[model samples]
Target chain A: MEKLLDIKNLHAKVGDKEILKGLNLSVNPGEVHVIMGPNGAGKSTLANVIFSHPEYQKTKGSIVFKGQDITNKKTNEIAKLGIFMSFQQPEEIAGISVFNFIKTAKNKLSGAPVDFFELKDEIAENMNALSMQENMQNRDLNVGFSGGEKKKNEILQMLELKPTLAILDETDSGLDVDAIKTVSNGINMFLNSDRALIIITHSTKILEKLDNYFVHVLVDGKIVHTGDKSLADEIDKHGYSTFKGK
Target chain B: MAKTQLEELNRNIYDFKNPDDYSFKAKGGLSREIVEDISRRKNEPKWMLDIRLKALETYNKLSLPTWGPDLSELNMDEISTYVQPKTEMKDKWEDVPSEIKNTFDKLGIPEAEKQYLAGVGAQYDSEVVYHSIKADLLKKGVIYTDMESAVREYPDLVREYFTKCVPLFEHKFIALHYAVWSGGSFVYVPSGVELDQPLQSYFRLNSPESGQFEHTLIIVDKGAKLHFIEGCSAPKYNKVNLHAGCVELFVKEGAYLRYSTIENWSKNMLNLNTKKAIIEKNGKVDWVSGSFGSKISMLYPMSILKGENAKTEYTGISFAGANQNLDTGFKVVHAAKNTSSVVNSRSISKNGGIATYRALVKILPEATNSKCSVSCDGLMLDSLSKSDTIPVNDVQTSDAEFSHEAKVGKISEKAIFYLMSRGLSEDDAKAMIVRGFASPVSKELPLEYAVEMNRLINLELEGAIG
Candidate 1:
């Protein structure tokens, strides 16, 4: 089968500093790929460049998703092409209710009129599954939310949007063990035969419950090693120092 | 992704102009002759004439204000203070001349009156062209009519309250307003009477290089309740125009009043309007204001709590676009024990526009245990735009509780990027953020007016995105 996303020697930079140099990755359907790297290994840059963040410049190479070259596409255009990124730090947009935000996003992606009550119920059920307060739907988006709640909100969007490829960037870094289990449960619920996910993290707490996944060791903007599941446990037992300067 | 094309929000609804036809147009200058001529045109009582003449003297004695926006561009020599339309005040809408009726028709005044208002007063230029109230309201002893008729038919009531809440000597523009004021609305809600519908007044300025100095006086008697809506707009012109209208409200003991205004003057116009209300024992006053137009605006509606346990609440917003400077806020004076006030204000500026929120809260020594809270936020769309907050808190007694919080910031790029990444166009992202910022004020307005304000915000944001 064709790859879901293919990146060839992707080189990107923000301002005058070069961040992602000579990076390459390929994601396939029904596969969970974990990219384990230390700080400054360009894990987050890889996630943002795929979404065409305005601040990041694609100096060289290309990014193709579903046979479409999205290297020069705008962020919203990329979003429309079934690509979603869960930000390491979500934005707090005051005065915009969470229900409205998700409804708008769903409409933009599907280009269909969503029934008000249907969408409201969908949001409420998702919040219940994530252990979020039902009143959160009426409050401003991510305003005054705890760190765990913010991460869970990102997961909620992933479930509602149902994109072909979803990138979770450090979603478990600041969450407690219970919140990590809830987030992991959310990810388990989103996995299906036609969907793919790229879990970018340094900790192994979120990957403990998942099965049948591939783990890649990313160091200095390059994936040095690829193995099945056990690679993640080795890194957790040890550290990224073994893979550094490779 | 391709940029989505959005149709420009039509401002032509307000930019349309009519031929400058009027029965009387005062000369472009200020003098005793012009003031006397206005009074004579209305055929006022000798006492009203004396008040106008005395106000003219006080106008000359006062100098221009030095603290706010510059007034050098304003030349009273270039402004015709009065322009009476070629029509008389008519009770029946059909009796109004076709041109004047067409103007109000375009503004949707008559339709709004039919759908939402209990009474309607439409003013064109310097005189009211049509005035009417429902028969049921009139049967309840509610007096709603033009200022000229109230001055002539109910002289004793008009004399007792006119210019009492806001003295002419308080500011230079107010003194000028008192001297040349012509067309306005007068509403007196009888004691213990409560109206389910609101009363609306629409002001349209059609003549070039002219001003509309209307006076609005409203009194809600003991245990009564009222909501008054004021709307103003004008067409654009090369020459500058001036608007210095005045409003005075009286809320009697245990009564309630809510005064809402949306001022959308042309960019070439300078709006310096004054509005004040006095709340008696156990009464409450609420002010809902939205300032969207005008080249420069310096308006600060005030509320004075005169009796124990009186309360006031103010919710206001202002949007300043290119070449516009909006200086607006609210003021409250706590004079009795246990009085309280709450103020929430928001401002948005883009493309070199300037928005300043200036406020004052004063508590007298006799007002013990009073409380006041103020919060203001400013959102600038671009780096070139500007926003400022200047708040003055004067407490004569330390026993009172007052708190003021202000925030000034540019629209966050990260927030914009985040929203866009969620599949929204950049323009939609910015507009959504702004509407969210202004929801606190919009939710307080009537549904129709809230929709209109949102459309105005969209129009202002059309060219804001590159």
Candidate 2:
């Protein structure tokens, strides 16, 4: 299998505090990687560091994506290389409509102008699948949106942009059962032979709908164990206490 | 990563110039003799001439403002009080001088008139060179013409409302404005007349070392409604230029007036403009303004709710980029019972620019049950830029409700990261955030004006981030 993402002994920090210490992971195309960790286990930090967020300083080690070193790359350059991360909490960007934001993102990723009508039709189709109102596209991005709606909007962006590697950081946290079902459906629609997904979540309720995934147990800034799909179930049943202090 | 080329955003698109071609030019300096020369050359009546002399005396007595941005660099003695264009005011576009018409063409004024406006007025240098109103509006008894013509034809109406809202003694620049004010628009919407389309006026100052102090007087009569759009631009010059224009609006009982202005003056221009509206019983006035270019600007459009249940709303945004200091805001005075006012102001400062929001809200004792809400949001693009909000609220009535909120900060690093992670470059992310910051004010403008304002914002954001 072709490796889509590889992190080798990644050490990162935000401000003065180091978060990710010698964390290593490898993601292959056509696979789902579940990252389950207790609080402060550097789960979200791994995602941010992979996307090269400016606030997260990669002090040591290297991150190679598709065999290219991107340790010092800017967030935008990394994003342009087909990596997308859904925030645990998306910022409210006033005055930018959801439709405009997605359209700009698609254009930037593809480096081509988008046909408005075609893009509109595609967004409408995906929004319908996500149970989002058509008027939601006209509203400011994530502003005044309910928590569930924000999560659904993130999934909608993922579906529209069709990035090769999608890092969903706690995307299922604030969602209701129905929203989770719809978001899972959207994620399944984005699944294909050429794409990879790294879903960082605490619960296995969302992972139950998918099949053939590798689950990694992260603790205190490093991954302690890796197993098949059963690992997620074991963690959900036993919690991270069994893996703590390892 | 390829670094985005930081192009110089200071290229002035309106920096085209014509040779010092003029039919008349007042001698450099501010004096009674120069004022008389301006008034006499226009063949003004005695009362108008006397008003000019009185204004000249007031201008001499008044000193530069002690607060706000410094005006010490502005030497009044070096500025020509007036400069009349070579062409006479023509109602027909074909009759306008080709050179002057070409300038308006370059600014897209003629095309905008054809597409959007019910009437169009083009002012070059210090005089309005062209003025025209649609036949339909004329048939509906709407009077739209130059201020000079209004003073000549409707002397009674002009005498009653001229300087009533913003008097010459209101400030030092207004005094200077009244002393040498030459050409502007005079609009009078008759009672119960609601025009379907907006009327527009475009001002272009082409002369160096000259001032364009055109007066705009608009009165929406009882139960009538009107929307007036004003645009101003000047070419860059080495010498200093001054624009101290005045706008006075009278919204009568049960009437509404929406006044919008986009001022993009040259960086060498000191834009000390004043505007005010007196709203009567149940009347409403909405002021939408965008200030983009100017070396130093101090503009605060005010509203006086003089009648019971009067209403006023002001939405404005200012962009001060590189070597610019813009002190802009809105003021409201609630003098009658049950009056209300809403103000939303935004400012963006980048590349060592300074932007300040200075606002005032006063609810008099008689204004029982009045309500006032003011919000000021400022965005600083870099550490070298500065943004300040100074709001004063004076409430004398216990029954009144007043609220003021202000926020000043730089773009969030997380927000930038979020946008960048969506495949946008850092520069693009910053520009998008800035545009979003100004969207509240721009969304209130007409579609064309909103697009123009966005374009101005984009141009100002170029090279804003390293």
Candidate 3:
């Protein structure tokens, strides 16, 4: 498998308090990596730091993506380099339609003109797959949407952008059974030989639908254990108490 | 992040000037002679001339406002109250002078009239050069023409509602407007007649160191409905200019009238304009305003709900960029039983610009069961900008309900980062947030005007990244 992302000794902080302390990980193409950690394990912070979120200051070390040093890049630049993140709690931007936002993002990242008709058809198809109403495209992005609907919208964006790497941060936290199935199916469709995923979750319910994955147990901002799918089952049954204080 | 340049963001698209091309120009100053000369040149009646003289007296007697934005920069002695373009009011577009017509053409007035307007009026400097209404509307007894002609033709009707909504003695700028007001529109929607399309008026002030004081008076009779749109723009100049126009609207019983305005004055302008509406029993008035230009602006469109069950709604937005101070809001007075009013206002300030929203909502003692709700939100793009919300709510009646909400803050970094993570540049992200912030007022405008408002916001946010 081709190496897609490499993180070495990454130490990050938010407002003088270090959250990600010398964390290191690697992601390969065509692989689904599940990151399971207890509370205050810096799960969301790691996702944000990878995207160079302004709030997360990288105090030390480096993050290399697709053989490029993107540690100091702006979020938009990193995004244009084929990186997408599904936020745990997305911000509701009023008066901007979901369809328009996705279209603009796709156009900006690709640096190409998009056919309006084709884009509409593709959006409608993806929305239908997610069981989202047609009017959802015209409504303000994430404004007044239910928790499940917001999560589905995030997956919809991920599918539309077709990024090389995606970081899903707690995407299944607030979803119901049907919504989880729909979201998992959408994620599965996005899985191919050239793409990679980093799934951050507390529960293994969504992982049951995904395959060919590696599970890493992260405790206190560092990955303590790494194994195959059985590791996820182990953590599901025994919890992260074994990884604590390691 | 690279700091955005304030100069690049404050660029003006309407900054071309036509050489001093006027058939008549009054000497720069405000005096009895200048006001009398304007009235005499228009060949007004004795009563109209007397009113102008009285207005001049009032203008001299009243002092400048003490509470709002400063007006120490306004020098009446340096501003020419009137500058008559060469062309007279022509009902046909082809007859208008090319130079003056091109100005309106660049502003998309002719094209807009052909596509969406039932009537169009174009004012240049101190006089309305072009005015026309659709034949169907004319056949239905709807009157839409220049105010000068309205005074000549329908004196009784003009005198009945003129300044009744916004009296001449209300303020110093209003008094000045009444004294030197030269060009504007006079619209009358007959009883039971409803216009399918809006009638638009475009005002262009081309001369430097001059003022554009146009008066707009509209009346919607019983069971009638009408939507009127007003647009203003001026070229930039080194010297200061003034725009103290006045608008008065009267909606009769069971009538509806919507008044929309987009004011884009130059940076050298001191715009102190006034607008008011009087709604009768079961009548409704809606005000949609977007203020985007001018060095200093003090505008508060008022609504007087005087009849039972009357209604008024105001939706407005203001964008104050570098070197601009805009104090804008709305006022409503519930005088009769069961009257109601709703106000939603938004403001954005950047690059040391100051935007203040000052509102007043009053429920009188006899206004039983009256309700009023006011919401004002302000957004500052950077630390250098300033925004304030000052609201006064007085509920004299025990049975009335009044609610007010005000908020002021800078752009959220988390929101910007989220947008940036979606592949939008930092500038684009900030622009989108500001556009969304002002969308409530823009959505209330016509489709084309809403697009123009968004474009204006983008231009104002060109380099507004923090």
Candidate 4:
């Protein structure tokens, strides 16, 4: 039984244009797969479809996570089923306290009352993990958070949910060097053999630890090339214009 | 099949109900007999009973509401004049039976009471079956109790404040409520009493298809402060349920009062409720309300500033999802020098729901150097849903300053694209935008309630867009 996510000919479109064209890939339990391509290349689309976003119409495709077909699952349901997606920009949920939002999210994933004392302790701990202020958990969900703070908050949610398959959508973008290292450690903390990670980012700076893993290059809505860890280094040195699937 | 052109709210609980249990009810009508029957049921003094008879005459002369949802369908003959839950008001929490206890329990009244509430009361059906207050508040001379007991025990106190501010002749609904009003809370803050915590009461209409005409009156005396929160709900009914209740608040000289309410009535209700507050010199009133349920509702809390340096702030949000027409807003009348009122409101209409915000601001000739500002924003998730804002500004004095601004718009497609470009699914992006649209109003609510408010917003927003 494959422990990783299997995407088979996943095709999706938004409005009139098709973004993800027949993309295909698979990741092992412990592998960290990075999808990189040009600006319009469907890197983020792949991340969204994997997390069962209601938009991004899935025309023809199948996404199997841990041997379960979740092609048409609700986002919250998909999240509870051990699939997590860290949005590139975390949403600012006004009026919703950070503690209450995370508590409900954790409950949805675990289907139980979050140990109040333990959850508070863990939230205090995870705030330090993301280099966040001690009172961040008490504040409204990203209401007045800065750009880098929003990304860190996304990573903070992912850490608490701790899904078996984590898909991070450019969460490292718009971060300073110090903040980038903090988010990078957060990814490492959630990395394990029993779980797989699908990180979609243009820069591989945060991918320093999990260097040698599967890399897929998406161009024109399709995974045109699949390679080892060095593929990311090649793409960084030479942009997507130098690569061709044929 | 085209979705049923769903209204903005599934407040069908305000619509229709099956009346299998009305207990002993009077045929809805304004007559001496009906009023006498009610007075007989409540066991009122002759003088008080005489007030009911006079109230009936006042009700007959008053005209029905000409604006908002049509109440012509509200047949007086069909409404059960009085329907009491078969229990008495219990001070000891456990003495309250399980069934009635379960209703308040579902509404999260006790939990909120323990957290930061100085007083709490739970009203089931047409009567208050349970009421309590923190001992420290009572010791501080803060009086919080059911209105029925207040009228009975403190007749002088009740006489001093009752109906004087919002008399029965104020309007038709007030007259109707005064005639048949059964259960609600009365909060009185004596001079110099500054309550630190909120006082709460949960109202539940459990008997199927019964009319609930409860009245809540709170008076903050001179140099005092208080915060009162009200919660209301009802079980679903197949017939048009009615809640023509009233609430009047009096914030006296240099006093302040904050009232918060979250009403989640079932979808079959015609929630034609009324509330008003009058502030004297140097007084302040803050209103925080969330109207998320009701089939057809026309509710607007009004504030009247009548003394120098008086101020008021009203923040409200209404969500109309399916089969609901919630026409709700607020009105502030400035009648004194340097009085101010600030109103911030938002409405979300989706799934064919209809949401409206209609308000009136009238500054009297003597209201010199007064200021008032109103900002209303509406977001319609789909083309079929509708949002409207009708505000009237009547400034009698040239020294009064007032501004009314509103915008009705649909969710931006570009914003959705921007969020999706940043990796959020279209649905998530839409939810985030809608959530943020309501942030101004929800942010004013307390902690746990804000989450519940967001959840209700999400529920109403799910199929609002493609």
Candidate 5:
């Protein structure tokens, strides 16, 4: 099977400080890849670099998505090319209702006219599965939302966008156990034989609920260890200290 | 996504101009002759002319405002204070000259009237070319007509409340307005009557290097309610144009009045408008305004709560694009116990434009137990743009409760990135954020006008990104 995303010796920096140094990873279709690292290990940097964040500079290497070189594509272009990232800290956009925001995004992604009623129904059902209030769709996007609710909102957007590759960056950090379960369930529903997910997380609790996943231990700006799901449990039991200077 | 080509402002709807064919155009300058010519041409009574002569004298004595946007470019000597269209006031839209009628037709004045308004008045240059009111409202003793007609038909009522709320001595531009003001709306709702629909007046300044001075006077009688809407626009001109219109509203005992205005003047225009309302016991007034054009603007609508339990609310927004300076805010004076006020204002500046919010809130010693809350926010689209908040809050009575909040900020890069990551282009993301920032004010407008305002914002955002 062809690789969904291939990153080779990716070296990136934000401002004057280099973050992602010589990082390589390959994600295949239908696989759940979990990246675990200590603080400053450049885990989140990898997620942002894929999107070509304006503040981050790609000093070296390349990122290929679905046989297309998107190393320097604009954020919106990358998004349209079927890449979605659930932000660690979701932005609170006032005045735009969640429903309208999702509809606009879906339309832009598909480049077609979306039926309003069908989109509304889809949002309602997804929000229901995530245990969100029925009126959440009417409220401003992420404005005044609780931490758990914001995380759920990100999941809701991921499920709605249905990208070819979805990256969840620290989405479970601030969530409670119940919220973590809901987010995991959302992830389980999103994964399919034709899709890929890269979950950059620190907790093994979420990994326990996810299946058919691999764990990669990142240290000092590089992924030094990669194994099956047992690797996540091993790292969770010990720590990133064992992977340091590897 | 429907690709929107970024270019200079798509202001063709408002920038198209007709030939300057008119029956009369007052020569550029401020003098007794021009002022008297305006009054005499309207066939006004002697008393009105005397008031005009007095106001012209006051205009000469009063100096230009020292604070706010510079007025050095506004040479009254080069501004024709009045331009009478080549037609008489017609009760029917078709009776108006084709050129002038086509202008209003292009503006959708007749269609808006047919769809929503209880009455409609169309002003071109300095004259009211068309005026009409629903027969139902006329039967209810609701007198809606142009200012000149009101001066002739209902002299007593017009004289009583003409300049009562906004006196000529209030400012230099107001004095200028009194000297040559023409073609505005006059609405008088009878006691205990409430109109379900709004009365609209659209002003179109078509002549170049001229001024538009329309006088809007509304008196909502005791226990009555009314909503008056004012719309103004002009085509682009090389020389400077002036808009110094005046609005005076009287919300009587137990009455309610809501005045809404959307002004989109040409970039070569100076908008120095004055609007005020006086609310009596148990009465209320609401001011909803949107300012999106003008080379420079200095407008601050005021409300005076004179009776117990009188209430007022002001919700306004201003957008200043390249080469525009919009100086606008709200003011309220609490004169009696239990009177209260609330203000919410927002502004956006881009491409080296400047937006300023200057406000005043005063609570007299007699105004015990009063409450006032004010919030103003400013957003700058580029670093070259500027926004400022200068507010004065004076509380004489210790029993009053007051709070004021002001915030000035630029578009958040994080927010923009978040939106762009959701599949929106940079321009689309910026435009969406701006529309969101302006949603609160737009939601306050009538539905059709809200759509129009959003379209205007989209047009303003084109070519906004460097």
Candidate 6:
């Protein structure tokens, strides 16, 4: 399998403390990779490093996206180059309608004018696909949206941007089982032959609809183990205690 | 000198007296002769000069403003009342001298005029250097010109509501403004005329230790609608630069007007500005303002709902960084039955800066069935910064509904942790949170303007020291 996103010996820290130490991961196109780790295992830090979050310092390693060394690119710039991260806690932008917010993000990605009818159709299709009501599109972006609703809105954004590689950082953390299923379905629909996904999670609930290509276990800021889909199930059953106190 | 000194805010409009070599400035303080000289410099009509002198006398007789932000530090005697950038206003950019035109270039006036604005009138110092509008707007019976031209062409109409809504004697600053007012915008939208785009005026003060008093008067006739935006900025200078401009708006029956302003003045500014609107039956007035920089500011945009079903909405936000005391808010008066008002104010104070939200929502006896709601929220970035909410509600009617709620808080640690846990950098998390807190004000703007607001919020969050 060809690598779409490659992280080689990545070391990143936030405010004087290292979180991702020598973490290595490679994801291929059309692959749905799950990273299961204990608390403080640098699971999300890897995602931010890949997406180029401003806070994470790349002290020791490199991240190559599509053969380009984009280790320190801005989040918006990385997003423009076909990488999207569904924030764990999506920001609530009041006074900016959902329609306009998504429209802006989409415009930035496409670098062109958005056709009103096509834009409306695409927004409606994604909202309906995620079971979001029509009224949610007109309200301020995540202003009054519930937890599950915000997660759904994030997926709606993911579906609209149609990025080549998506790093869903706990997209289902605060969701109920039913909502998790709906959000998983939204992610599942985007798993095309040209698309790849990296979902950071310790729980296996969001895996109901996603078919796994690989599962990596991160312990103490390093990917200590790599295995098949059953690794997630094993971790969920035995708990992160298996990798703890190492 | 007819300037009120409000000293509670540890502020003044002056510090550095001589930063550069310049001329054309008047002595500080206000008097009848001062007003006459100002009118004489502009070559005003006899009638207009009379009004200026009258306003000056009224200013002398009126006491200092006792309400709202303090002005004790605004020394009228020390302020150079007027600094002329251009000898006369010009319609073409090139015809304007290079120095004055260069100032506008530095301020990005021509670029903004081309990209976003339908028309633009730029005031360099105390005088307008350039004024021009798209020919189409003029053909549509929309009048957009400088106040000086309006006096010569439409004196009767201009005088009818010039000081009718906001009289000169209302406050000391206003009286001084009327007396020393130089170049400002005069907009008249005819009935049923809807301007497809926005008209804007950009004021840039380049003179050090000088004052810029420009009057902006807008009248939207019945069933008409317009959106006028104002952008003002002065570069960092050591001296005091005063901005005591006044804006009076008349929204006629069934008409609507949305006024937007972004004040990015330097910390040397003692912004003693005033704005008010009178909305008639079935009319609406919307005020969208953002104050980003000032040393000390006392500004309150008021809306008086004088007819049944008239409404007003004020969405504003202020940001005060280190060594600044910014006092800004809005007021609404429900005068007639069924009139309504909604005011939402937010402020962010950091680096020991003081951010205040002061507002008055009044319901008169005749304003039955009227509803007024005011919500103020403040965000303090650190322990040193301070935020205050002072709201006054005077309800004289029994059938009115008014509610006021305020919340002042520090940045949420839980929110930061959640965002960081989701792979957002801590800085990104905080920036996003601050933008979210100011989202109400940003969202009220158009697309480009909203993006500008976000950029401002991001910039202010960079040096946010704990």
Q: DockQ of each candidate's interface versus the true one?
A: 0.58, 0.59, 0.56, 0.09, 0.70, 0.10
Candidate maximizing DockQ: 5
Q: Which is the winner by DockQ between candidate 2 and candidate 5?
A: 5
Weakest ten-residue segment in model 5 chain B by summed lDDT: B1-10
lDDT of 4 by residue, B156-175 (tens): 88888777777788778778
Candidate 3: tens digits of C-alpha lDDT, residues A1-246: 447999999999999899988899999899899999998999999999999998889999999999999999999999999999999999999888898788778877987766778989999999999999988999998999999999999999999999999999999998999888998998998999899999999888887777669998888888988999998888889998988988
For candidate 1, the share of real interface contacts preserved is: 0.77
Better of 3 and 5 by DockQ: 5
Give a tens-digit lDDT track for model 3, residues B1-466.
Answer: 0112221333445777889889999989999999989999999988788878888999999999989888998889999999999988998888999998888888889999999999999999999999999999999999999999999999999999888899889999999999999899999999999999999999999999999999999999999999999999999999999999999999999999999999998889999999999999999999999998899999999999999999999999999999999999999999999999999999999999999999889999999999999999999999999999988888898999988999999998888999999899999888878878888988899988887887788878877764
Q: Show where candidate 2 strays beyond 4 Å.
A: A242-246, B1-12
B-chain TM-score of model 4: 0.92
Candidates ranked by DockQ: 5, 2, 1, 3, 6, 4
lDDT of 2 by residue, B1-466 (tens): 0112122233555888878899888878988888888998889999999888888899889998999999999988899989989888999889999989988987889999999899999999899999999998999899999999999999999999987888888888898999899899999999999988999999999999999999999999999999999999999999889999999999999999999999999899999999999999999999999998999999999999999999999999999999999999999999999999999999999999999999999999999999999999999998999999988889998999988999999878888989999999998888788888899988999888887787788888887887
Best by TM-score: 5
| Stretches > 4 Å off in candidate 5 | B1-10
Residues A1-246, model 1: lDDT tens digits: 999999999999999988888888898999999998888888998999898888899999999999999999999989999998898999999888998888878878888666789888988998899998889989899999999999999999999988999999999999999999999999998999899999999888998888879898888777888898888889989887888787
What tens digits encode model 1's per-residue C-alpha lDDT throughout B1-466? 1012123356687889999999989999999999999999899999999889889999999999989789899999999999999989998889999988888888788889889999999999999988999999999999999999999999999999999999989989999999999999999999999989999999999999999999999999999999999999999999999999999999999999999998989999999999999999999999999998899999999999999999999999999999999999999999999999999999999999999999999999999999999999999999999999999989999999999999999999999999988998898889879988998988899988887787778878887987
Question: Comparing candidate 1 with candidate 4, which one achieves the higher lDDT?
Answer: 1
Q: After TM-score superposition, what is the CA distance of residue A190 in candidate 3 from its true location, in Å? A: 1.4
Angstrom error of the Cα, residue A184, model 6: value is: 4.8
